[model samples]
Target: MQVHECVSFILLKDNQVLLEKRAQDKEYDPNLIAIPGGHMEHGETREQALFRELEEELDIVPTSYVYLCSLYHPTGELQLIHYYVITQWTGTIVSLEADEVAWHSLEANPLDIEADKVALAEYRRLSLSLIIL
Candidate 1:
């Protein structure tokens, strides 16, 4: 089986994180609420893909971000997902691809995808460790 790689980001600002409701007609996770991101194209590095995806999905360019972790999951399509926490960015955020988007409290656990939930837990762990350091 061929494994596909992708990147997802948690966009953070002022104690809130950006979340999106995927379009109901999307092929993968239709109507699910999760952080916004997309798959990598051929010949692109992870950061390149990240930047492109952020631009395409959110209409913003991330200026600051940190890699959180990667996860492997086998669904109909196998995936190796690289997750990141983006703390700073430029341009106003407007959802260009999702059905709807909003900012939610950082403490809220509202994500609907299992991979997203695991990625968020890893983000929270890293955030706490940073505060202690």
Candidate 2:
């Protein structure tokens, strides 16, 4: 099976993380709350893909961020996701394909979210250390 590369951004503000409710029509994880991200395109670096995906999905450009870690999902197809913690960005977030976009507290239960539960757990565990002062 081919392993695909994807990128995700954890945009945090006021101790809360941003999440998007996937559109019901989405091929994967429809109507589930997840971090903003998408598959990486050919010839694009991880950062470039992150920027492009964020723009396409939310119309925002990250100004500052830090690489977090990568996680693998082996549901149907193998997927490797590169996660990042975005500290600063420019432009208002507009959910183009998602049904809704909102800021959720880190303490919010991740069980309700259908995608990347492990990554969420990891983020919560390392947020204090990963966050820039």
Candidate 3:
């Protein structure tokens, strides 16, 4: 099985978090809300991959970002997901790939939305440090 690395960013503003709904035609988790991100290119570093994915999917460039954590799944095809918190950015958001995008209450229950629960929990758990960093 091939191992893949994926990067995601949680963009926050005024206590709300930006989320993107996956296109209905997408192969995995169609119509599910998720953080903005994609697979890393062959030679790209984690930060490079995050920047490229954010640009491609949201048409914005992060002015500053803080590494949150990584998740690894060993079942079936191996997957390693790197999570980041983007404190600032440049350019207006344009949904280039997601089906829909919106800002939801940061304190909202993750189960109430179609997002990645694990990552959401991690973000909430580290919200304080993330803001301080």
Candidate number of the best lDDT = 1
What TM-score does structure 3 among the candidates reach? Answer: 0.85
**Higher-scoring candidate on TM-score, 2 or 3:** 2
User: What's the alpha carbon RMSD for model 1?
Assistant: 1.7
Q: How does each model score on TM-score?
A: 0.93, 0.88, 0.85
Candidate 1 residue spans exceeding 4 A from truth: 131-133
**lDDT per residue (tens digit) for residues 1-133 in model 1:** 8989999999887878889999998878889898898889999999999999999999999888888888875656888889888988999999899999999987885898889888887777877888411
Against the reference, the lDDT scores of all candidates come to 0.87, 0.81, 0.78
lDDT of 2 at 123: 74
Q: What's the CA error at residue 84 for candidate 3, in Å?
A: 0.7
User: Model 2: number of clashes?
Assistant: 0
lDDT of 3 at 24: 89
User: Tens digits of per-residue lDDT for model 2 on 12-94?
Assistant: 89988888888898876677778878999999999899999999998999999888789876645677889888879999989
**lDDT by residue for model 3 (1-133), tens:** 6878888888889888888888889765567667767889999999999989999999999998888888864433466878888879999999999988899887773332323567777777766665544
Q: After superposition, how far is residue 38 of candidate 3 from its true place, in Å?
A: 0.4
